[model samples]
Target: MQGSASSDFDSIPEVALSRIWQEGWLAPELRTTSGERVSVIYRGVWTHAHGPDFRDALVDIGGRIVSGAVELHRRSSDWRKHGHDADPAYDAVALHLVLCDDAHPPLRHRDGRPIPTVELVGFLSAPLDDLVARTGFVELGAIGHGACLPTLAGERELDVRAALREKGWERLFAKQLRFQQELSAFPPAEVLYRGFLDMLGLSANRQGMARLSELLPVTTVERTAADGGSKAVTALLLGCAGFLPLSPGEQALAGLTPAESAEVDQRWDVLRQHWRLRPLPSYSWTLDRVRPANHPVRRLAGFAGLVSGCAPDGLLARFSELLGEAPAAWETWLSSANPPFGSARKRQIQTNLFAPFAYAYAEVQGQHGLVDWVAALWEQLPGAVDDSVAKRTLRQIVGERRFPIRRALDEQGLHQIHHQGCAQLRCFECPIAELAMRYEQPVLYHVDEGIRQLQEEIGHEASHRLREG
Candidate 1:
């Protein structure tokens, strides 16, 4: 490794170069050969493996900031020798760091996004001692997931919130159109029941739930509501889902109380004979990676209670009337407690099921005011409660910063962006990425200090979790 002297520029080892970044000399005030100053943040989580030398680093060129993997080389053209331009794994690279400056400022990944190149020619400096610190945390791995600080930093939180709200409203209407398509084949009542039951699957098993709804049919449940109440409908759903216990003592139904387990067994026995229909076999129910609360049986019970209480008119009508009032109006609306759908899950149902269908109903009837009111109600509901998706994506973008999601609409927007933008790398269509592209200075990260502060504030639990995620 060469010393970080001016004469030693060409011979600087890649590791010594990394020390210069870790020390923050290459972070600010470095200019491209075209005389445009560059700013960088989160020199990126260092990688000892192949592919990009740095993953998820943020870089600012002129006024725009971008985030992605970063490749380091002894010379600008080494990337060509390495053939990274043809590699899909390097497609997300935000910046390319090289020791020697070259004419090629625009590098294209195999996927076609142009990568920004910044040579540390005028930025490197002599270290006070032999470069000994391992630069950034090599062992801790990626602290956060995406480099979104630069993207989100360019705008006011209000603007981001507004964009998120708009996206959410847009999604609401999109759902309306999708629900309307269902309206063409089935009655509105059947469509409403289908919407409610499908969400029981909670993304993973939604198709499975929808299939079960078809097998039992909401019409058949309505027929039994008078004689058997919710218990009969629950029996029908659970039996059809193949989730009914073969025995009261079955381990699969272990969480249920003895009485409740007996009820499931008793109900299934009577319903099995009454319908003379064979269950889909337990194999039909998807339990893989499923949480207990969202298990198909519990969700079926939850829907059964709603269905049993459903007005003689229809579920759509009930939901429409409920949506017209404040969220608190339905406080005691649901009565299933085996696995209680708490306040968060209740709000989740409102956002995912109630709001969209309410808006759809309003549109079909030309109730513009109801449409606006439902949108307003949607705005007030809290953002998604689970930390699963937003936390992961937001951490990747913002790094150790607090998760930026606030409104339920915002969480939906994040999901939309993640699905539509980040996954497809459609930065041009993404507001966040578009904002990042205009940033004068990408969020510059002081890796050593940031780590110290993050650890000091939340301690090792967060860091350990951050790495684990």
Candidate 2:
């Protein structure tokens, strides 16, 4: 693909053109033939290998940051001529560049997946070879990170906290808006049940859990509840969730006691008669890199226990009543759950799921006072036990002073600043970024030993992790 240009745009060597892309010479916002914007973050190191022209490139296509290979071709069909079209090695390619769209249709992978192709013909004004000759490759780390740190270092401490608080409110309203949309269609009970299941899924299996909630609704599961013992509850829920082992070996049964195993099997039989629907595919649950206790089986058991314990009031009522009560009340119920959902997990669920829905429920029922109350409680409540974004933001803004945010609202606020501000590298618009601008050079900051230094500096660290049983 990298050869002398063949009559498409004069005889320009592609080696020079490849350097144009690798060094970020083209407009930062590249326009594809299909007219979508492609923003280059890191153009990646040029490779002399047999594959893509560039490797390890980071690009922002449609807001999602993609890291992969970038291929450059004089003509779109060169992809096929070079055998890259059918090569599995290029499977991770994120971008394809061509001088012209002389080929009838856009380029596709060997597997027939359409690769994003951007035509450089219209964007190219001067000859690329001249541009390459004029400008040498950009120096190391030209695309710098933490653009706002230099400015934020000189600001008063109180101003920064106030800005964070304001950003936190922005995050709350953003979440509330999303929850309002979710609640618009489904009934309160249906929405609440789905939300809880989705919460239990955490980051990995939220979609699977949501699907399970939809397939086996509260009404459907309510019909199956006779006594709804913990063993029976876990069996029914896990069976439906597709977490129950299809063929249990000794290793599969390692975590459960013999009594628990017998109880689950016995309860599963009862569920077989009441629940007539087929179980979901075993692959529906996420297991890779998941801790044992936080696995779908245990979360399902906890969900079943919560539903069984709070049945008469219904899941919605029990959950709603709990939000208004003390935080200890939520932890108390979590403590006795079938597989016992840890307090750390409960806090994540409470902040992400309950906070939004609680406000939405109150708003729908015309309880303005309740809506106000939920907002107040959300700000004071503790956030997730651990949030990666919070740690990242802390490192970005925290120069010498350690920024420790324990409250849910404060933590959520930092997330907004990170996503909207830091991720975008919008140093000027970001409130903290303004402070960072005071210095000509950005403050040098690094996450010291994974937030360990920050924890020691603040003298407070949430060290609670639910280890595998």
Candidate 3:
């Protein structure tokens, strides 16, 4: 194996470490820093949440089998630097794995007991660089031109758009119904808050973000902001979200000002104890290749600001009123002049959070006019995001035709079609497929056959993996 520079070890991504763990590439029988032998039983599920990297992992430490969370970092000092020491979420951590043991180990847990540490620098099956390369991630590939592209491009383009708009309305109604269902159980403020968090979470961390909102409810955020102001709100949300660093040194490294760092550290200490709050699990956030402007920490900061801004009445009342106000007012309230909270993200917040929620709340109160206003507003909101699903659906339906998704409603229509048709592999049943059949009748059959073949291939791949396991 080729040797790697120490700097290479420093730069190793946490996700690579996770991949390595998932593959069981490290030496099976290992020795912890305390001289105890360790053996893997079940490596556990890769929880892409806040607390531990791997959860429910079973391991044998010196003849005693243990099942708990497993945490990983590039360096052993990251345990304290990342503030896991102060977080009760790591209390059940059974084993600590690190690439380098720069600091002394076993590292102490929140309850003061030393966690068994395994330094992987010496135990890896291949060179560090090779392992890192092997663990590299790949995104979804491009889809080819579909059978319906030619016919849909000529006379049927307008008809296709109309079809999509109809589906978009269906998608909008579905979202409104989901919000109504949520409102029936919880308060409107809570439902809106959870939805906002889900939008902020984006694609990667949506589930984890929704889970965080549930853990720290809207009422708590409102009450905390009212009592302690923005500083307190910042500490509460970021701390609970597992973004606040425990030590002043880590805070400084995280680019926090001295006063800001002190406030967060001091406030979180009191808030965690008083509220009996637990931070999300380790590795809950997906930070790899994420732009800094869209980092979970930054989004949490934006949420903190929003919480403080909305104060006494909470998000529900404030945003409901804003629905009647100008778009500028909505932009200001959502972004607060932050560049990271750009127009695109704000548009998404509107499409996903505001419109459906307002419509749902209005319908429950018998405010039919207000519901209509929200539905109208949804149509006018410009499309800000052009994601993979929209692109893929476009390729399948229109080929290379430059049919722009100009509005949020159209994008929603694309997603609705994808979810209902492409994702379900129900090509023949799709409205788009029906539209395609009118032009090139064989297009629907070919598309349906292609989907069937893909499903069979997927089934075979899954069965092969199962048999190997």
Candidate with the greatest TM-score versus the true structure = 1
Q: Candidate 2's residue-wise lDDT over 1-469, tens digit each?
A: 1222546343444555676676665665877777778888888877644578889999887777889999887677766656675678888789888786666676777777778888775555456545645554222111124233534434465666677778888877877777788778878888888878888888788878877887787776654553675566667777776655433432142346666767776777767666675678867877798886677776776677777787666777777778768466766766767567877688877777777788888888889999988888877788641668877776667644555567777677788888886775443346665444443243433322323454665543221110000
Name the best candidate (by lDDT).
3
Give the alpha carbon lDDT tens digit for every residue of 310-340 in model 1. Answer: 6354465566566646566554564343345
- Return the number of clashes found in candidate 1: 10
Q: How does each model score on lDDT? A: 0.64, 0.67, 0.76
**Window of ten residues with lowest summed lDDT in model 3:** 137-146
C-alpha RMSD between model 1 and the true structure: 13.4
* Full ranking by lDDT: 3, 2, 1
Candidate 3 local lDDT, 1-469, one digit each (tens): 2357767765565767888999998886888977899999999998755688989999999999999999998788878777777889899899999877777555787668888999887788888788887865321111122545446655677788887888888988999999999989998888888998898899778877977888898888999988887778878977898877645544433446777877787999899998999998857888787766566677776677777877877777788778787355787687672224756778888787788888899999899999888878888877733678878877777765677788888888888888886775445446676666466555545555655676687875433332211
Clashing pairs in 1: 41-444, 41-445, 63-439, 63-440, 145-395, 145-396, 146-396, 146-397, 148-397, 383-408
lDDT of 2: 0.67
TM-score of each: 0.62, 0.61, 0.61
